[model samples]
Target: MRFKYSIPVVFVLALVIIEKENNIISKVSDKLVLKQPPMVLDSSSSLQLLLKPNQSVPSFHFHPRTSAPVFTLMKRRLEDYSSHQPRTQKPKQKHILLLATTRTGSSFVGEFFNQQGDNMFYLFEPLWHVEKMLTLEGGGTNASASAKAYRNVLQQLFLCDFSLLESFIDPPPVDHITSNLFRRWSSSSLCADSVCSPFVQGDFEKFHCKARKCGPLNLTLAAQSCRAKQHRAIKSVRVRQLDMLRPLAEDPRLDVKFIHLVRDPRAVLASRMVAFEKYKNWKEWGTRGGDVPLDDDEVMKLKGNCDNIRMSAQTGLRQPKWLRGRYLLVRYEDIARFPMRKAAEMYRFAGMPFTPQVKSWIARNTQVSPKEASGVYSLQRNSSEHVEKWRFSLPFKIAQVVQRVCRPTLKLFGYKVVNSEKMLTDRSISLIEDKVFNSL
Candidate 1:
């Protein structure tokens, strides 16, 4: 008897796509609830990295020919490695780093790669470790020295290349889509462990951050061992602290990939305002003190927070043009345009291998349309209506205020405010008051 293989056998071996539209049970104003794919991997392969309301697990399937390994198998292997377990002796060279502001789709992008198995480690907020020395034992009694240690720890953690240190710093970058300021810091000479700036002296340390005991020597060994540790790494951190990343990126060992994910200001503003309004006032809504009602000062502080992040995001996109070859600007509109294409490009940019199954997995799980079809087999285009829904969703007065504040930045991203004349003419609404119109 001869062994025979057939297409039906291949199809049977393939994992079917899951449709998620009907499953989208909730829709928050500006934020759309993505339908979860029914075809989830086993719990062992699933990662708990995602924040709630957007909790997702990366899924994979195997190729039919050559009995290629199942996507899920790769996912499991990676999970083991990230958690610090050994899978294979061979080291992989492709490492990727993603840099972006909050709410700019960095989380989702990181998640996409993470689902691919032991290839990429999704490191969120790599700077937090260094910044935490102020609270840790033996960090330092003096604020200045403490700050230096904090910065040093962060540098070594990210650049030193230890799997254990991955817990402390973001993995190296094969690609980085970071803000201009962050790119500046990550590329700075002063960020090194040895170069303790004056800021790390006297009172400066109290205000700034530095790394701890993990200096250049220990970091070097870690870096050598973990150099080819993960297939790739993605870093999505706040823009305010980008200045710290300067030194580590200088090393020839670090390969940084840049991807800028931007959303239309109107939508971003709408989404943010709604989130704040709902969460900030939760206590008043009787959620058992879950939400805190903020006074004018608090509201102002929140507004500033929003403005800072938005400004950082805007600056990140603009700054890369000066270094065009190293960066790629991707709009939320475009990513939403054909998420699969954008995802594939991102994978290629990160130097990771994109399996056919991964492509299928994205199509099925990332469906975001009115239609109910969602699964590895189905694909949908980005909803244009969602792109500028803020025009209608946000109140006119608030929209005006947002426009006043965000207009200049919006222009930087290639968008112009709709002037009153254009709004009146376009909507065909008379500007004159009703009484004046009647008298006329």
Candidate 2:
């Protein structure tokens, strides 16, 4: 009986020993696995892994001993994932807002961008209607509200949305007769391009019947086409301050850039005086006299305009970093003097290639004698001759007042103040005369 019991105990002890040996072997195998470098999946291996059976999957993780290669694999996988992912589309359209005051050659600048052929759609003072709308809404005196509305309107206009403009269609801004004319012309052009003869006939019922199907009648086709173009630009002298457009300038959805077109105050005053004289009988004339000395009201108006110019210059110069590459300060005098060079610079700033077609347009529009260029509101001009014409034409008293009111801005823009005789004799050019001088 003792022998049998001892034999059973011996068998139990043997079983325990075998189990201990198996545990030791398993631990050694694990150590060996840790000693080897982690396996990383290359493109082919990764693809194979993707194809493999779900239950027989290799581990994506590595042994703790090879943490470095594990991280490398992680980085590689991330790169691969990014490379294989679908790319997001970027905004195709770009907007250019020409920030300028009245009589600062903004119209010429507008025409320059407009004549960029089919790829460019140019709007002349789209904000005039906004101002009128603001007045109608009784928010004219509230600068902040007016600015917000103006920016909102600009956003819609840039996106080629004209539904908001229907409200202002019936009785548009009285001061914007030119804006009305442009609307009529655009409507006529769109109708000509897309509408049938029956739609255009005097019979209102037939026109209305066809108009429902012809969507171009509701919105500007030029503007709609512009949405797909390389560039869309708008020029406005109504905007008195650059700060008012800070939101638009910094918007990422719309690639917006600003061209601050400035003119010498003395020259601007002289032009206004000349216009005042030419259109004295016109009720819409902002200035009262031309040959006669400036009345108190006229002087005050000139002073206010000069102050606005100064403010705009200061605002542009102090732009933040985001606006650094977007804001371009251009002088009317410089553009007038060197049309081709300045235009090329402008195109570069606007991210457009300067084609031979653009060069041809500049040459055709700008090749005119000073005598022939006079009394015409056109892009063609004897630019060099036009630059200093204000010096000879402006009266001495008027010059002094403009010089005094615009002294700070004159200095900022590199314009010099001189006596009447010196103004005629001195060949002092624009202070900021360099083609590539973008202080902003």
Quantify all predictions' global Cα lDDT against the true fold: 0.43, 0.61
- For 178-220, candidate 1 gives per-residue lDDT tens digits of 1111221222122234332234222212212234311122233
Worst 10 residues of 2 by lDDT: 173-182
Scored by lDDT, model 2 comes in at 0.61
| CA shift of 263, model 1, Å | 2.3
What TM-score number comes out for model 1? 0.46
lDDT of 2 by residue, 1-440 (tens): 64334333433433343343544433433343455454633333332322324323233345377665442443343345435656578546779888888788888776667667656666677677667656745333356776776677777777776555544544442322112323333222233343312234332322232223332133444455546566678777767667778778777778898888998887877677666664242223323444334455666666777777777777677766767777888888888888888898888888877777678877876778766677646566767777777777666656676777668778778777776655544556433334444454
Q: For each candidate, C-alpha RMSD in Å?
A: 24.8, 13.7
Number of the top-ranking candidate, with lDDT as the measure: 2
Superposed on all Cα atoms, model 2 deviates from the true structure by an RMSD in Å of 13.7
What TM-score number comes out for model 2?
Answer: 0.67
